[model samples]
Target: MIEPRLIDTGTARLRVMVEGAGPLVLMIHGYPEGWYSWRHQFAPLVAAGYTAAALDVRGYGGSDRPDAIEFYDMAAMVADVIGVADALQPDAPVILVGHDWGAPIVWYSALTHPARVAAVAGLSVPFTGVPTRPLGDIFRRAFTDRGRFFYQEWFRAPGPAEEEAERDVRGYLRRLYYAISGDAPPGSWPEKPAGATLLDGLVDPDPFPAWLTDGDLDHMVAELERSGFRGPLNRYRNHERDYAWAQAWQGQRIGQPALFIAGTRDPAAFGFGAYSDPLTVMRPHVPLVEGHMLDGCGHWTQEERPAEINRLLLDWLARPPLRL
Candidate 1:
């Protein structure tokens, strides 16, 4: 059974679901999601004799939500992860795993505090080079020729976006989730035209796989409904601040064993050419890295294919790293 506990990180109280035994493994969930996202992996990891903990990042689930936008900055986020590790294990490092936005936090943590991470794994989102250019420049370049992928612009917009999202949160969140998963309702986005806004592509009605059941969706919706979208949505707004903070580690390299898993159908992978040429950017920084592509999965790799994800994670954790 998974036990829920709160780890006080000085700045915020992180609500975490922990189970299993042995070395600590900390899982971080992505945007619009919480600790529950890793529900499937918790029990399996426990049964396999590993301690697993999934945290509701600050502002999501039961974690403390600070009203200031600066509270959600990358440095603050990294601090929370370290705080969780300090509060729980105190002496030992942890195997860090993250999905989507969670991936970057783990990446930053591993970079900022190398001694505290045993191994690192990222699902759906690969570690791109630290943000060298402005977030606006990156967005403009990524979406310049493709109008269909413009919804990222909305995410970068000011206060009104979060206000609107919080207005009819359930519906807004459902649409956002469906859009990113590429299961938007009918006529959401024509496959032929690649230049659609991210939100536009999310309206399709395709049925998601069993991994992301209606119950799982409801859990996410309920969390957002209670917390309101402001705090979580603000995570996207801090790109510029994050870029500045990451500059300190310009030449730092992540030497730990790293694993990256992506869904074959995940547009984010396709957008960045991670599948066709995985080594181009990521391999240079994270030398000991392995990439896996799940054919039928979407952006939600863990939820869409929990069994496969579990198998991969278990096998990776069981084996010794190349260096050791």
Candidate 2:
């Protein structure tokens, strides 16, 4: 059984779903998602003899949604993770696991407070070489090769995208979720088909993955509809802020036992160039690193292939930490 708890994380009140008993494990979800995104791994990790908790990061689910973009800054988000650890397991450090946007937070947490994380695993998103360039340079690097870079900028644009998304949130969310999950036409990754903007009007009778049922979509729709798109979209608006903070830690390496799990078909795998040279970029910082590419899967690795994700988590947890 999963038990829900609210922890005061100073910046916001974060709601978490926790279960089991052993070394603490903290799970972070990505944008347009909540702790329910980790529903597949919760009980499995618990049965494997680890106390696991999946957090609804600030601004989503039951967590307080602050109104300011600065409030969603990397430092504040990382602090929420640290605060959760402090409130739940004051004496022991946690095994950090994150998906999508959550992966970035894990990377930051491990970098900022290495001692607080026992072992770290990132799903769908891998640790790119840290921010060593200005916001414009980062944008250019991200999009330099073909249309690889426009999507990130699209999210940051303060115009129709956000407005349309907020107009009919339920439909907009369904399309966004589908787009990332590989429901679009072939070769949709490197570049979207001609005239296919990311935030274009919702397709009639949206094509969501079969793996995600109406109940799952309903959960996402309800949360996003009530909260609107601002809270989540604001996460993208802080790219400059994140870049500035990450620049402070340039050349800093995260020395934790790290693992990255990617869906072979996930756009982000190739979109961010994470799969291109993961060993060179990730292994340098996290010396003890492991990578898994799940076949026939998309961005939503946990939901698309729950059993595989569960096995990966169990195996990673079994491995001893670097200094333990």
Candidate 3:
């Protein structure tokens, strides 16, 4: 059984779901997602002898929502992870794991606080080291300047995004989950002109891929209804700031044993990641990195392929290298 706890991370309180035993494994979900993203992994992880815990990273779900965009900064987000670890394990080494936005947070956490994180794993997004160029400029050049639609760029402006998303929460979630899902038709999440909104020409599958259920969809819709999209979208607003903040730690590699898992079809796998070959791109920054590419899966790696994700995570966690 999963137990829900409101953890006081000193700065911001977060809603965390925890289960299992043995070494601590902290799970963090990405943008537009809450701790429920890791629902499938909790029991399996517990059975595998792990204290698997997932948190509602700051702005989503029952976690505290700070209004300022800057409040959701990388430092603040990473602090929440560390604070939860300190509270639960009190300086004990933690096996850090995350997906999407959470992936980078945990990577940065492990990079910045290696003493606290014994080893780390990321799903979807990979650590590409400090940004050589600001992402905003890159996005503008790649999408905006060329009059193409980019979801990240669409999210940069708070007002329009919140307004459109809040206008129809369920529909928005449906389109997003379906379009980027592995089951989507070839043209589901294709690029569009810059002026288009996120929902323009978006289609929602009649049955969301089996990985996601109506109950799961309802949970996300309900939470989003309460939280709105402003805080969540603000996460995208900080790329430039995040890039600037990382100047202090340039050229640092994640020395700890690390694993990366993502659906082969996930946009982040090749579409958005700096390098089509994740291992090649990540090797320079994360030398110890190893990865698994799930066949026919999309952006939502954990939810899309829960059983496989659990297996990979457990097996990797048990490796002798991670023990030392």
Candidate 4:
């Protein structure tokens, strides 16, 4: 791995880990995860002759964390992506790959600044185009209003979620990670009654899955402990704002080569009854696209199945649409 550094993106300074040197491939990680989440991909990406850079998404790890909730909005996040690309390779566009919240971040980066992003790919979450309404509202109707627990709804508030997670960072990470992973037993993430905290129904599996090592958990725990859950949880607080800002491109489509990957067992991949298939849901928004669903794979796509994810990514990068 190459040395990590912080790049000033005007709005904030983002910590980035970079490796190799060729056509740039910028990776963005999802909630409760830092650039370290993409640790499995850098070596393979470098070996395949592509410069790989993964960033902390402005809030987690070594990146600057803004106090205001609005600072973590979609527009600001997109700017960070462009800023990183410009800092790394000002002369050419870069490829983007994201997981979970990172998925939407990269999708919007390509949509809002097509000139800077040559192609885009997402894991665990598919591009659904510009939002007509906030997902929080949808979750409210589906889960909250019906007296069910929705993690995002719990995260929508400011202090409570942070306190709960921060009180026991390792325990929180352990339970959350295990609960959503494919390794968890069936019915691990069952719907809880309303008023339940994010950690209420989660399980802390003993002898944690082979995919996530003790070293990995220690690294993640250390970062979250230093940064606190405020910035990471703040990402969920901007759903309403994100929906409103996305209106500028209400009808816009990401007219770039795209790829998507997800675990078959991943709850986020099911689209919450909005769509049954990710490929079908993403096709309209991303015309030139390809997708793969790893059997029994969970939210941690690349980490859970690094070999398969690497093969899919390298194969996609080698395709005709994106020869770089």
Candidates ranked by TM-score, best first? 4, 3, 2, 1
Best by TM-score: 4
- By lDDT rank, best first, the candidates go 4, 3, 1, 2
Off by over 4 Å in 2: 140-149, 182-185, 189-197, 201-207, 271-275, 322-324
Clashing pairs in model 4?
Answer: none
lDDT of each: 0.78, 0.77, 0.87, 0.91
Clash pairs, model 2 backbone: 143-149
Question: TM per model?
Answer: 0.89, 0.89, 0.97, 0.98
Candidate 1 or 3, higher lDDT?
A: 3
lDDT of 3 by residue, 1-324 (tens): 889999998999999998877889999999788999998888887887888899998889999988899988788888999999988788578999999999999999999889999899999888888778778888788878888888889899879998999998988988988888888977888778899999998897786777788898899999988887778888898888888888789888899999999887888767464467777788899988889988899899889888899889888988886642
**Model 2, 215-321: lDDT tens per residue?**
98788778767666666777888877888888878888888788898876686666455346554567777777898888768898888889998988788777765
Count of clashes in candidate 3 = 2
lDDT by residue (tens digit), candidate 1, 1-324: 789999999989999999877888899998878998898898888888888999999989899988888899999999999999888788988889999889989988998899898789988777766767666567666655564344456666657566767776656656665554534333333343334333444442445434466777788778888887677877887878998999999877888889888876676655443246544568888988888888756677887778999999888888886221
Q: Which RMSD values do the candidates have, in order? A: 3.1, 2.9, 1.3, 0.9
Which residue window of length 10 is worst by lDDT in model 4? 267-276
Reference-based lDDT, residue 285, model 1: 86
Q: Which candidate achieves the best lDDT against the true structure?
A: 4
Candidate 4: which stretches are off by over 4 Å?
none
> Which regions of candidate 1 are displaced past 4 Å?
144-149, 182-201, 204-209, 271-276, 322-324
